[model samples]
Target: MSTDFHGFSSGPDSAGGAPRTVVDWITVAGDQLIATIKQLVADGNVRRVILRDSSGREFLSVPLTASAVVGGITVLAAPVLAAIGVIAAMVAEVTLEVERTDVDGVNESEDGTPPPSSPDPEV
Candidate 1:
């Protein structure tokens, strides 16, 4: 489905949330996660925030309060982080290639030169 508020869209519903499945959890989690980060940034007492995956996998640990030795660093850093992420994703898409080459039994010229045994071989 599509999120109208932020214009974000997710992939197909595979987690079986039907009308109220994992998507709801994801949406709620996203909202809560942003709010929690903002809160931690605003509190100025928070030293850091450790985030983990749903399967208990440690994903990231960020030092927001001590990043800049000043208050409100996280608040200022959030947009920069987001922009970096977007730029990184775009670069990845531009640099990464996954096409399959047909190398089974194909033989072609390598340096714009035909084979020596060809009938029309150049002198």
Candidate 2:
């Protein structure tokens, strides 16, 4: 399904492995949401993008990878944008989870230690 929106663009591909950092934030506008998404992807370190409502319900989760083939997380951005635009019109708050990868290729565990390495070749 395709919908027209001004300034809409695809996000970046993520690398395989555990994210180096998971950032959480509350946004009140779709534009901000789009900007944040684009910025995270543009940085070329993001591994996932998760969206949730104020009720703590996960609405969307985009697991990204650095492969040139665009699938998985890449296809969801448009729908997400459409939904966020609709939600923006109604004026609501949503939570954002941005998972970014580390440049050193170390997988960080929940305890903040490097875990086992992934076999996926770096892009």
Candidate 3:
């Protein structure tokens, strides 16, 4: 259940939260969907999650409130995750589209590494 990912250029922002938004596409085997989604949830910056089958037909769109699971939200999310798992298991492979925010300037790059900092202008 390996994954291949690519990021798309972020679009205009709406009122609220982090100033920047980024979208990433991850292609993964069906068995790995749950793990991927869980990791994204834990990242604490994802704004949305969309699952699509091999044909590019989207099956699920999950709108998350800035990736944090507060109290009873975790309980509510469990059923959604379970439903995603069941749908994923029926397909061979699927694409996961994620929209993440750069909360407090924390970069959520694909490699799990922060983007390089820029040189100070005064230097």
Candidate 2 per-residue lDDT over residues 13-102, each given as its tens digit: 225433345343434344356555555555565577677776767877776677512443365456776875665455455556656555
- Which candidate ranks first by lDDT, i.e. highest? 3
TM-score of 3: 0.70
For all the candidates, what are their Cα RMSDs to the real structure?
23.4, 12.6, 8.7
Q: Kindly report which residue pairs in candidate 1 clash with one another.
A: 17-21
Winner on lDDT between 2 and 3 is: 3
lDDT of 3: 0.66
Residue 44 shift from truth in candidate 3, angstroms: 0.3
Instruction: Return the lDDT, model 2, position 105.
Output: 42
lDDT of 1 by residue, 53-89 (tens): 4453444455543554365644447664574344334
Report the candidate with higher TM-score, 2 versus 3. Answer: 3
Q: What is the lDDT of residue 87 in candidate 2?
A: 55
| Winning candidate number (TM-score) | 3
Residue 2, candidate 1: C-alpha displacement in angstroms? 22
Candidate 3 residue-wise lDDT at 17: 52
Clashing pairs in 3: none
For each candidate, give its TM-score against the true structure. Answer: 0.36, 0.50, 0.70
